[model samples]
Target: MPAKWVRTFAERRPGVDVELVDCAAAEAAALVRSGTVDAALGRPGVNAEPDLALIRLYDEVPVVVVPKGHVLTAADELTCADLADESCLLPLDDVLGWDARPGTQLSHRPETTADAVELVAAGLGVLVVPMSLARLHHRRDLTFRPLVDGPAAPVGLWWSEPTSELVDEFIGVLRGRKAGSSRGTREPVAKRSAKEKAAARRERLEAAGKVPPRKPKGAGEPGARRRRGGR
Candidate 1:
């Protein structure tokens, strides 16, 4: 989605370029706060640091990942209490921060999500994570079912003070604003005159090869002298 938005922004502002910087969920807010990145896409709980502007995007659904043939797999969805007897491996860096984590606590928590997922795959425990994370480290031997009663992760756009035009432009794209919309453009282009509209359309057509290059004024008129005729 960010890539698509970048492309759209480039098409409108041809001189501007967007670069995505990868950061851990725990560090995303600090990266933006310290001016290391123009903006970040993350959830509010971890990425919404104080004084940073945030625009909530959407709610991310929660899911529980379990090995194949796990009893939870037999059901389409699960609740926290359903896995009370199972061991839950909680990474130290868990971003979701579920107030009600499922299952029993692990004897030793993993250090990161990848490690926890590995433990889950090894049948040491099951993990409750966002559906996106579950899909990120997907394995053929593992599958996830929705956690019907879990907290929904609220994802958002985070940026620090003195936001740039490019950041605002990307925000508009995420908000579904058209290129010519007032939020994106200083003035709407929809009210352009017919002549202005026709000229722009011709330029676009010429660029796209949908129409022949326009002839120079009077170049083919009957009385006009050809460039190389009778030479």
Candidate 2:
């Protein structure tokens, strides 16, 4: 979605070169702060530097991934206690900051979420992660169910403070603002035609007893009957 947003906004404003950079969350934030990149898109966790600003983009709920025939498949959401006796496949370096639950059994830590996902596919153990990661590493033999009591990860856009024109334009796009307009721009007031003015005058005249008011059309009226039959 981030890539798509960049592409759409760039197309709307030609001559702007929008580059997509893939890096660790912290590194991405650093690059944005250093002006190496115009803006960074990732989870929110950056040191509060003087020249940086962060704006939230979206949030994703954490979930548990299990084998197709696992017992947890029958549940809509599972608590940490639900997996008390089960061996969980935990990643050594999880960005979600997940720690082992009290008294829960854990399998040997894998190097990455991809490794944990592969282990889960092999029926080794269950794995927990954000819904986006589950979808990212979706396998035919595995399925995911939300972890009811789990924490959510917030995704956001970060840029250097005292933004440039290009960065400001990109921020506007991310915030769903239109070009050449202020944030939360309102629709233009519509002009009333001469016929509408005449109609309004006629209604005012009728209201003042200068002319008899016409009866409002009911469902049985000719126009209403025609509309119903057309449908």
Candidate 3:
């Protein structure tokens, strides 16, 4: 979604300069607070902070990555109890943060999700994470299934409050606002002229691959109203 929003922002503001910063999920809010970045797409954690605005983007479903032919794969989905006997490898950057983590806990924690996935492929243990992360470090020897009882990974767009116009424009893009949408504008919509409204409507229709509906027969002609009787 971030990539899509970036493309949308670029297409909308072709003359504006754009840059993307890659950072740890937990550090996204800090980056915004420190003004190191204008905005960031990060996992939820910014609500308690002041002078910050965040828009919840999405909730990623949790999945467990396992080696191919694992017994857990026999079933479509596994519950916490299903993993009771198997080792569960939690990476240092684990996002789920499940309090009552399913499966047996191992002393050795992988440094990152990719390493956890490698261990799973080696039959060392199963690793649970958001579906997107599993897909990120995908391997041929590994497969994943939805962890039905697992927690969701909620992500959002984080930025400082009282944003500048440029940051607001990017925020609008992340919020799926139309290119011409007036964000936080106090002007009344009546400010637009009838011709301008019509043109805008036409543009929207064109973008949607729709043709404007034709007027009823003689509808705009003077005295063209249909008679009540057959006469």
Best by lDDT: 1
Off by over 4 Å in 3: 45-51, 184-231
lDDT of model 1 at residue 69? 95
Worst 10 residues of 1 by lDDT: 218-227
Tens-place lDDT per residue, model 1, 1-231, is 678878888887888768888778888888887788888888786544778888888888889999999988989989888888999988988878876676788889899988999999999999988898899889999999998888888888888767676678778888889888876975666688999999999999999999999889756768676576666
lDDT of candidate 3 at residue 110, scale 0 to 100: 90
Among these predicted structures, which one has the highest TM-score? 1
- How much is the lDDT of residue 123 in candidate 1? 98
**Which order, best to worst by TM-score?**
1, 3, 2
The estimated TM-scores of all candidates read 0.77, 0.69, 0.76
TM-score of candidate 3 against the unseen true structure: 0.76
Clashing pairs in 3: none
